[model samples]
Target: MSELKQTFNSSLGKKLIMALTGLFLCVFLIVHLGGNLLLFKHDNGYSFNMYANFLTHFPPIEVIAYILYLCIIVHAIYAYILTTNNRHARPVDYAVHTKSPVSFSSKNMGLLGSILLVFIVIHMGDFWYKYKFTHSVGYKEYRTNLLTNQTTVTDFTPQTADFEHSQSFDGDTEIIRVKDLHSRIVASFSIWWYVLIYVISMVALSFHLVHGFQSAFHTFGWVHRKYKPIYEFIGTWLFAVIIPLGFAAMPIVYFIQSLNK
Candidate 1:
């Protein structure tokens, strides 16, 4: 038991965990990006929102999403531990370190990582919590725009004289509100500062992956003269394409919306 614990606690075991989780997250990002890109298609909001609604409510999918969230948390904890250990080991910061022909993103991995961590927190709080906890059957009111430039009425009214209760509104008619998902997303990216921050965070993510993707493989003792190049090439290409496309889509959507308006 002690031997098993020791082996798992070793650096090699942690690296393998990180590499596998990181690869899983990479696939998740692709699927997430594909879903979000639908926001740019104005005619697609009903479909997109319906899709999001289905994913959130579907039992099997919700189970998988929860597991994905757990993976993210575990990955973050492991990364924090690994980084802190590395930092403690290298007690002195070099004043004049030169880049060794590495990409800028590879060189500034720590900075990139920190930015991505912040972005993830904000992203989750804004979307995940709202969708998961707030929109219950009778707990909270959903304020949606039923008409252009007009706020919709409250929909939760009691039946006639069932309104003897303190919280009942017997005279009001039930309102079915409509939501514009794309507009809300575009509004978020419309602010100049948000656009700047979004772009910077994406750049940071790209840089973080530049080193992180292939480095994970090496950390797990996958180092060899022959296969290292293959991993490097594939990792770099995937990072280059995925992060930029995913992040840039929001800004482009906003830009096009601006022109149309």
Candidate 2:
């Protein structure tokens, strides 16, 4: 048991933990971006609200949400530890430090991570914390007619403040009520400074993931030469490009829509 503990307390163990947690968070980013894409629908946020409602109220998803939060904290902490230790171990740089083509992100992971951490706090505080703990987010009632396959949304007022979400059927129509997190999103994205910050953070995210994703695989000893190219391609294009652009597009589109309104 002491030997096992010592392994995890050592440097390699720290890197392994970071690898596992980082990959988990990467999967989460894909899922999260997929869900957030519903924000692009023009249905007055019916689909988006339903998605938000399911995530917060569903038992299994709630458990995963907590796990995701813990992983983020652990990943950040371990990253800071490794970064500081490396810096102290070599306090002076070599006059001719050889740089890898991908070393820009490798060297700046701390700065990129710090930016992403700030963005996550601001984002969760605006949406997650308010939706769960505060009444800052209003309510919406979405009534979908089964016959017509259409949904109409209206403002909802709960009889009790404790109410979070509800679902029911009235004849051929489904009545769903949930916190109006969609409106909160629109309100947030409408602001120019917020959009700027979101975009900048996504750029940082792209750089961070491009390096980190590939490194995570290498850390796990999966560095087969035949599959190295596949890992690099997926890491560079998916997490580093598509995911960040997908997230960045939401705010830009929403802000543009707000300008027209």
Q: Top TM-score: which candidate number?
A: 2
**Alpha-carbon RMSD of each model:** 7.3, 1.8
Residue 128 accuracy (lDDT) in model 2: 93
lDDT of residue 143 for candidate 1: 38
| Candidate 1, 1-261: lDDT as tens digits | 999878757877776777777777777777787777766665424445555666765899888788788877777877788778888998989999875886776556656777877888877765665545543222112333434423233334434422211222223432332223334455666677767777877877777777888887887778898999998887777775666667676876686676677
Model 2 stretches astray by more than 4 angstroms? 92-102, 169-172
Task: Assess the local accuracy of residue 177 in candidate 2 as a C-alpha lDDT between 0 and 100.
Answer: 90
**TM-scores vs. true structure, each candidate:** 0.74, 0.94
| Model 2 lDDT per residue over 1-261, tens place | 999889988999999999999999999999999999899888898888878888987999999999999999999999899988988999778888565765788889899999999999999998999989998789999999999988888999999997888999999999999888899999999999999999999999999999999999999899999999999999999999999999999999999999999
What lDDT score belongs to each candidate, Candidate 1 first? Answer: 0.65, 0.93
lDDT of 2: 0.93
Model 2 superposed RMSD (Cα):
1.8
The model with the greatest lDDT is 2
**Clash pairs detected, candidate 2:** none
The true-versus-predicted C-alpha distance at residue 210 of model 1, in Å, is: 1.9
